[model samples]
Target: MLWLDLEGAVNVRDVGGIPTDDGEKITRGRLLRSDNLQNLSPADVTYLVDHVRLSTVVDLRSPAEVAAEGPAPLTRLGHITHVNHSLLPEHGFDATAEALLVRRKREEERFPGDPSCAHYLGYVEERPDSIVAALRAVNRSPGAALVHCAAGKDRTGVVVAFALTVAGARREDVIRDYAATGERLHLILDRLRSSPTYASSVDSVPEDHHRPRAETMEAFLEQVDKRHGGVLGVLGSNGFTDDELDALRRRLRT
Candidate 1:
């Protein structure tokens, strides 16, 4: 994972240069994973727009989160395409932010053990359509596509892992990218703590809850292979055709 040195977002990184199972590296500047873009500085905007040529912004945050945070700077600029593909259930869109987070935590904690892995799997099992759509957006992007959630750890991590897996990125490399978020957890949490929408949610949760463990993502990939036949199977089952899959591979692989 190549960390993007931006003044606004802390967990932003390039999901490129990952070695595939077939021995090819994912093309750089084609895909990016990031945290919220609600605080992007002027220089940050210029860098992403002018230098990176970011063409698509796939936001994994829920409708409530988007409403609370307001429009991101890129959205206002109107040059880039911003698509909200919320991984969480939209049934609770009207709920308070605290209530929504509480509901999410409860769902993740449903299993006494392995809450993190379970939560990761929930994203696939619960909202496969959104996952498919997000990737489709990436497939259609004319330039680099930026995927992001609130902290760029859980939801964003899940989607990026799925995309990389489908592109034949090494399993260990995918896990490494997911676990890399732990290295910047403090900065990510600090940024979230400053937001009214996320501050209360993070305040009640322990720091350990935010850490991205490799084992969690490892088990997630394992379960996907066991249950869905793999990333391609998940995508196909969720309405993504072979053409779409090929397009995605073309966009990511070198």
Candidate 2:
């Protein structure tokens, strides 16, 4: 029942208190999800380090976004960034300027952004190797861990969805978990959409930042199913061993 709500941290929530399909509840405070900590206030930082005691932070943003976050402690920084292209849009202004958000596979196929759906599909076909490596690194922990991306929406969603599925959540339940991100994050997204950096991050007008449509989120989930054949299917196909999955189940589900 422990939850930490740091004022400056967006989308911060414990994955505990949620139940698995077998009627087991996910232990709270163990696995957490959050938006970037770039603007964390002193109080927010203090609360994370002292109150919630998050000793590990698995940052899934790219190196550039990592730089933007100022400095990361060497000890707690997990190298699990960019593990999946499952639910994320194309990165930043590149996605918006060229309207390539949904054409992520092409971008991945090219090792850069592109608009063709085929190339994007090709790219997704080759992502399993890197993703497995990323996951292995960040899954270790003795304290609370926060996994995040810049916006904590797409990439973060995929991982969270995967975890939920492994913990025995149904696809719909996994998706429901992903969609919960918007609950307290509207204000933060609004602020970012209006910030000076907004112009550089997106091509759309700040006014259009209204809210993420349910359809939009649904599309990402659909991609996961269509592309990966389902979360566990994708995980197994991607080289996640049975033992590793067992570890995840043990560590993540209570």
So what's the TM-score on candidate 2? Answer: 0.73
**Clashes in each model (backbone N, CA, C under 3 Å)?**
0, 3
Residue-level lDDT of model 2, residues 1-254, one tens digit each, is 23457666667778787777887787777678777666677777667777776766666665445544456432333532223222233353234534654455445554332222333233245455544554564466667767776666656665666676677765555656766766655655754655454435544445345333345445555665676686566778878889988887887775
Give each model a TM-score.
Answer: 0.93, 0.73
Off by over 4 Å in 1: 92-111
Model 2 segments more than 4 A misplaced: 1-3, 72-126, 194-199, 202-223
Q: In model 1, what is the error at residue 152, expressed in angstroms?
A: 0.2
Displacement of the residue 186 alpha carbon in candidate 1, Å? 0.3
Which tens-of-lDDT digit does each residue in 15-97 have in candidate 1? 88989988889999999999999999999999999999999999998898999999888998777898999888765546777
> Against the hidden true structure, what lDDT does model 1 obtain?
0.89
